[model samples]
Each structure stands twice: as structure tokens, then as C-alpha cells.
Target: MAGGEETRKSTDSLAQESSIIDTFAPEARFECPICLAWLRDPVVTACGHRFCRGCIYSWLEREHACPVDNMKLDVEKDIFPDNFTRREISQQKARCPYIVRGCIEELSPLDVESHMIICKFRPPELPENEKLRCQFVDVGCTDKFEDEPELQRHLESEVTKHLSLLSQAYTKITISNQASTSAIAQQANFWDPPAKNEQVSTSEADEGVNALLRAMYEKIVVLEQKSREQDIIISNMSEQINSLNLSMSKMQLRHCNGCYLWYINDFKNKIKDMQKDHHLMFYSPGFYTSANGYKLCVRLNLSPRDPNYIAILIHMMKTEHDNTLEWPFSGRLSITVIHPIESYRNIKETMMTRPELEAFKRPVQDLNPRGFGYTEFVLVEDLKIQEFMRNNTLVIKVQAQPV
Candidate 1:
């Protein structure tokens, strides 16, 4: 019984094959020599032979000859449609190409191409179950599975192993990228050509270095200008500071007590100005008394009323401390005039206050001048001949001793 069943199956298969073969006529009139299939859109050539329109046209392009007899043919003028043969072929039934895969459909020759498109057994599409591969295939994973779910299960089972591989891959990629970047940077910073002569390369390198130096020089110039501006600002500040110091020194001089030294510069110019004004006297600014409560100054006369002599005088002035001082001032006064010549003795004088002397009288009011001095303080000829005018300056020292 098993042998009989096998024989029957074989008979069915042979019948199906025979049925498919019969659809295309074995006769030469229906068969196209090009494709050996039943003629589609049959057309007759000038040589009295028929072929499918496309087959004849393609054949004519290469040789201008009829495919059957090698007869020379003109494609546009010799080919004519064999409408009767086309209609006969269209009515002939053909088995589907998928008949071996259990498709049982039969269609006319004209409808076969369209029917094959929708044929159920035309190698049914690979299901999702059989289309999966390992997710790491791009990273050298060669494993595959029957389905996506199976692949996912495999991945989960070997997750730790896969992760280690991924880490190694990532490290390699990172290192490669870093190396590539470094190579690019090296290429960018230098102009080393493999084929160029050493001398040429060196010359090019020198030019690049010179360009860099020029840029640096320009920056330095800008910095230098900024430095100069800062210097100017500092210089102005220094001048202001010096002017303030000078003002403070003058203030200190105005308030000093005891002995004070005075320097007279431009003595010749001062003397000339006084001479022009017919005023021979020049007074020093007020200095404090030794007691620090009274203000006094000195007067020097370059040309006194006596033509051959110079004169010196002393004066006292009212002050804010007047009300706190003892009345009827009594003090010893000493004065020295410095000669420019070091070897010469400085003119020195001292006097003790006396109530009877008008110059020593107590102040009745501010500027009630009762001053005292010598009419012939020094000889003018001695000043000119004795080197007493060095660098047009004169120095004088004065002291006051309160009794």
C-alpha cells in the first residue's frame, strides 16, 4: 500500500509538469527562438517569419537580420504585428511559476505576469521569525538566530560578555579617533612634504616662522604704546606728588619753631627787581618763635640808605596764640648771614630785648612796627669781591631765645 501511494504521488507530479508544458505549444510556429516561450505580441518580419515584437526589434538592433533565417531586415519597415497569433497565445492557459510550491492557480498567457505578482505560493515572504541577526554584527558579531525574540533572549543571556566586548570596541574607537586627531594637528602645524628637498622645506619653514615673528612684533608694538601711555600717567602723577610735597614743606617751614635756615635762590634777579623798584628790602616769610607761639620774619636790604652798605632787620607779627602769651615780650635774638665763601666768617649778631627800646616794646596792636636792625649790616663791595653769591643763591640762619 505504501508503494502504491508513492507511485500515485509521482503520477500527480508528472501530470502537473505535463499540464504546465502543454500551455506553451511545442510547434515552431508558436515558440519564440529568443526566449523559447510561446510568442507574446507576435509580429511577422519581411522574411515571412514570425517572432515576438520585442525579440525581433532587439535582434534587428544588433544585426538588422531576421532571427530565424538571418535575412537582413529593416526594423521600422519590415516588422508587422501578427494579431491572430497574439490573440491565440492570449487565450492559452498557463500554470503559475509557483505550482511547485503548492500554488494551484491557472491563468491565460496574457494574464500570467499579473497573476504571478499576487500568487499565494510564490516563495511566501521570509517571516519575521527567520529574519534576525545578532545586534552586534556591525562590531564583528557573526551569530544569528531564527527570530528577533530568540536573538533578544540570546543577547540577554550573554549580556555581560557582550558589554565587555562593547567596552573594548569603544576604547579602540576612542584611541583611534585621538590618534587621527593628533595626526591631523601635526599635519596642520607643519609643512613637511615627503617629496620636497630638504632645503626647500627649510626655506618654507623659515618663511612661516618669519610670519609668526611679524605677528608677534606687531603685538609688541601695541603693548609698547600701552606702556608709554601708562608711563605718561605715572609721570603726571609723580609731578602732582612732588607739587604736594613742596606745598607741605612750605607749610612746615611756616610753622617751625626754634632755629630755621632759609635759602634765597635767584638772588641776583631778586636784587635787580628790588633795585628797579627803588626798594632794597626783601622779607622772608614768617617763621615760628622758639616758644612756638609767635611769628617773626627777616628783612634784608641789598642796597640800604647808606650807599656802601647792606642792611638787615627783624620783625614780629600777631598770631592766633597772642592771647595765651605773656605780655611785654622779652627774648634774646641771634642772626647769622651766610657768605658763599666757606673760608669767610659768617656775619653774626645777638641782641637782648629791653623794655625801654622801641623795637622791644610789647604789641599794642597787630603790625604796630617797632622793629630793630643794623643800618650797615655788611659792605656791598665785600659781597661782590668775596665770592658770596655762588650760583645766585644766599643762605641765612636765624634763632630766637625767649627769656
Candidate 2:
């Protein structure tokens, strides 16, 4: 019986403590309908309803009716401060919501809101299962994982891919930075300002001018360097194009059986220097006769050793397929000195090669010394006539026919 009575007394004490807490607890009427918390700065509506002044004011912005009664309300005239209700709430003692989290302080209604904002025990608004994104999101890593551990694992697994993306981004940034730096460097005014007249001195003026000139010179040098680089690249490309053309011509010559025509422009200018020089002669580069591969060239002497007239010659040259060709060549050649005036007839000359002629024979070396030609091909004075010289240019045409 003694043990049972002691147990009952312990239960009574617990019941009494619970009763005391209920007696001090804020009533539902003292709570705001919007926040469901003890009203702060309590205000009463025309319908005799109480709510926190801030809550009602914010609600009235989006609505005209009261949250509880759904009755029409006016924010400017229907709500009045209830100082009595505010005082009652402030006087009531409230246990901290974080009591379970080890908060030991008791607070009034007025201080609870401020405490909760800084409370360490407040539950996180976001759920723990929600994913976290990568810190490198700006660089294009869009990966999200359940938590920090998973995110770390993802980063480790994709390290190579991430590094490559970072490298590309870094390269772009570097290029942009270089361009910006170059632009800034070119603007001399951005770095130095003009001096005032009163502060100017002969030495100072000279230094400033020299600095400006130096900046200008540096910019010019950079531009000139870029221009030279571009020129070199263009020259290389031109050389390659010419090489390709020469190769294509050689290939076509191996299969072509048709006669080849050669046209030389600015003929007078080309021979003028040769005429003045003791050399007195000009030789064209070799060209193929036919697919059988007979190579020949045309030569001109402005002032021959004879000195009476202009000399013309035709000679044979070594060829890769010389062994496959007829030993002594037999062909016809035509040369025309075109008159600049369209009305004038062109001067023409023709020659028929024979197997017995040394000029028609296969070359022993790269070229032969003896060639077939007329020493008195044309009068030198006739070539100097105005009709043959137009705009300081002359045109010569040569055709080779292989039978």
C-alpha cells in the first residue's frame, strides 16, 4: 500500500505541472489567423477580429476580405491597434520552440519571433534528399547529386571531362584577356593625360612628346609586323599554286598530241635591256611538242654578230621520254610578230624541220648548241616602227606543229 500511494503522488505532481502550463498558454483568440502564432502589434478589425498588424496589412494588399470572416475590410479605416491584446500577449511567458534542442530560456511573445530567426535548432526549410549542384556550374558542369558525398563522387569520376571543359574555358578567357590588353595598350591617352600650360617645361614637354612618339612607333611596328607576316603567308601560297600549275601542265603534256601556242606580252621591254647588254639574246623556256615528248625552245637575238638583221632560232632540248621518241625530229614551226594596231597585218615566219638537220636531232645533253634559224630574219628598223610598239608593249606568238 505504501508503494502504490507514492506512485499516485508522483502522477499527481505531473498532472499539476501540466495544468499550470495550460493555464498560462496563449488562447486561440490571441493568435493571428495568417501566421497561426501569438499576435504581435495586435490590431482589431471592424468585425472584432484580432491579428498581427503586419500580417493583416500584408494580406489586405492582395485581398479586400478578412482572412477569418471573409467579410469586406478596408486596411486604412477598418483596422485599429488593440493595445490591450498586445499587452496581454507580451505579459504571457512562453517556452522556446527549441526547448527539445536544448534551449533553456523562457521568452515573451514579443521576443519569440526575433529568437526564432537566429535559433540554431530551427529545421532547415529544404529537405535533406534534395540535390546540390556543382560549384563549377558557370563553366558548364550541370551535375547535381543527392548530397555532398554524392556530389564529391561525381566530381572525382568526371575529373578528366571537367578538366577538358575548364581548359577550353580557360583558353577562351585567355584569348579575351589578350585582346582586351592589346586594346588597352593601344590607347595612350588612357594611361597619360595632357599637361597644363603652366606646368610645362622644355624638358618635360620633350619627354611627353617622346613618350607619345614612342607609343605611336610601337603600334606602327606591331602593324608592320602583322602586315609582313601576312605578306609572307600570301607569297608561300602563291608559290604553292604555281608549283601545282606546273605539275598539272607536265601531266597534261604527257598525254596531249595538239600543237602548243606561246604568247609573250611586253615583248619590246623584255628585249630592250637584252639589246643594250652585250648578251644580245633571249631564250624562251622549253615546252613539249607532243605526247611523244619532243622538247623545244625559241630564241631571239636583237643584235646578231652579223649586225644586219634580227636573228631567230629553234633548238631541241633533253626530255625524260627522249628514248621513246623518233631520234631525228620532223616538225613545222610558225612564229608571228603581232602588230599592235588591229588594222596592220602580223609579220609571220615558218620553218620545216628535217631529220638530217642538227637542230632537229635529239639532244646529247640538256640542250644543243647548233640550232636552225635565219640570221637575217627581219630588218631591225622595221621592228622599231610605231605600229609595232603600242603602250610600250609588244606581243609575240609562236606555234609548234609535230607530224
Candidate 3:
């Protein structure tokens, strides 16, 4: 009775933690079980629960059970990308993070950051009432709309009109400043002190010149602001693209039907760099043994003891299937250095999972601290002479399966 009561309490606590719903979104379905937040890059488990890709991976590093129910899950087979849920969550309207500062704009996830970049309310000094002005009101343009989308459309459609206003201002400023060019050149702005001999600009004509200069300065400031916004948008887009590319590449490596190939590029540079950094190493993206099997990764580095040779190690990675799969996983893990045109020249080694070794046991962390494999996989000179490398690139294939 005591053990059963304890189990019930544990289950109830996990359920409560996982159910901390996000009130910001329209529905609770988008919340990640592990993160207690809106799921980004969501994935679904076989049990039909959704989680953020990163959150689930991090969670599985320590616990092999589902966050919601403590049910076992297989990282390889049970987990699938929840594209539908991701789309739904992204499309759901969300308020600006700066909404507390008077930004009344609500935007989809896709446009929120870009909108935030140019949000007039984002300026701390601007009053709530002042942020309601049109985007170009400072540039001699009329305030036409108060609606955010309507304001955007007006800005887009009225570019010519806005330009005309600027041109007219520039022309007027040019004519007015002609008489004061010498005076203006001597001083920077209305704020700047006059020359020792010159008087203060309180006269009507002098006031007119200062106003034109201020208008010109406003135009310059607006242009600079627009340029910086573009730069931020570009930087954000670049980061998103890089992240997408990285995720795609890792997925390709992680889910390649169990047979994984690692391409070591700039081989000569690696060798040279290895000399300076004796512990220099490269890790292959984590791969699975089967669709529902053990997750593993390979490590390659130059032998610290024998500089002429390379070292290779295979590490068991913690996965959601830890509870279901065999502990001290039994299998034959092999690594082969390929000689594409000459199959016989490939250097190969096969290691059996020793039951007594910690390297073969269920990983206690995201990656097992202990690794098993060859310390001297092959000689550098031998690989160079054996037609092992192609285009300064070396390829290795790793395969794991039950005996």
C-alpha cells in the first residue's frame, strides 16, 4: 500500500508539471510536455504527446520515460516530427513581448520578431498615446491609420507620396538654407553654440533655417533607422536559415536507416591542427542502430600516443528507449575506412559489446562518459598510399546490429 501510494503521488506530480498550460495560445495542445511552454520544432511520441525537439532530447538524457505519464518511449521509433502541431502553433496569434510597454500589436509567430524590430512602442521614451502616430508622421507625412495592418499597407502603398514629402522638404530646406549656408557650416545644429562673433538664432529668418536643418536631420535619422532595421531582419533571417540547415543535416545523419557514413573533410588541415591541439577530435552526428534501437555516435582523433595513427571510439548515447531496450546492449559494432574503388583496401574493425564494460551499458547521461573501440584505428601513411582518401576527404562507415 505504501509503494502504491508513492507511485500515485509521483504520477500525479508529473501530470501537474506537464500540464502547466500556456494561456497565451488559443489552445493547450501546443504546450510541450517537457518545457511547459509552446512547442518549437515540435515532435510527437507514439503515445500522441507533443514536445519540443530539444526539450524531449534533453529530458531523455536523464529519464527514458515520457514526461506526461512516465511511459517508456523509443527515441528512434516512437518520436516523430509534429509538423501539423508546429504549423498550428506558429499560426496562432500571440501578443508582442513588449505589449506591456504599449505595443497593442498581436502577430503570428512568423512575423512577431520582424514586427518587434520596427515596433514604435519599443522605444522606451515614447508615450502610449504617441506610439499611435503613423510610421512616417515625423517625415512630413500625414497620419492615416491607427490599425497595425492598415498602417503597414498604407506605408507600402504610399511610398511615392512619402518620398514627395521628403523631396518637398529638401527643396524648401535647400532654398531657405542658401542664405545661411555659411552660418550653418560654422555650427552643427540649433543645439550647438554659435561662433564667438555670431549671435543666437532667435530672429524669424534664423529660426526658419534651424527648423529646416532639424527637418533634414529628422529625414537622415529615419533613413538610418530603416537601414538598421533591415540589417537586424537580415541577421535574424540568416540565423534562422543556418538553424534550419543544421537541423536538416543532423536529421539526415541521425535517421539514415541505421547505416551512417561520416565524411572527414580537409584531412590535411585536421592533421596539422591535431599537432597543436593534441586532444583535437571530431564527433559524427548521433545515429541509431535501428528504427527503434540504440542511439550512438562516433569519435575520431589522432592518436595522442602514436601521432602516425588515428583513434576511434563508439559511444552509447542515452535514448528514450533505455527502459525498454536491453541493458548493456549486446551487439556487433563495426567501423570501416572506405577505399571506394578498392573494397579490399578498406580498414575495418568489429567489436563485441562486452557485458562487463561500462561503455556498453545504458548511458547515464546524454552521452556515455566511457567509450569503447580502437585507440589506433589505422596509420596515416598507410591510408595515403592505399587509395583510401578521395579529394582530400576520408569516409568512414559505421554499422551496429544484434549478433
Candidate scoring better on lDDT of 1 and 2: 2
Model 1 per-residue lDDT tens digits across residues 277-344: 65656777777774446667777775456656766777776776777877556788887878766745
If the candidates were sorted by their TM-score against the true structure, best first, what order would they fall in? 3, 1, 2
Error of 3 at 221 (Å): 6.2
Q: Write the per-residue lDDT of candidate 3 for residues 26-124, one digit (tens) a residue.
A: 346766766566688899998888888999988887898898988898888889998888778767887664543456687776466568568775422
| Positional deviation of residue 39's Cα in model 1 after best superposition, in angstroms | 99
Please, what are the lDDT tens digits per residue for candidate 2 over residues 155-201? 88898887876565444422112222233232332222221111234
Error of 1 at 59 (Å): 99
Q: What's the lDDT of the predicted structure labeled candidate 1?
A: 0.64
Which ranges of candidate 1 are over 4 A from the true structure? Answer: 1-225, 236-244, 247-256, 340-344, 354-370
Clashing pairs in 1: none
Give the number of the best model, judged by lDDT: 3
lDDT of each: 0.64, 0.65, 0.70
**Top of the candidates by TM-score:** 3
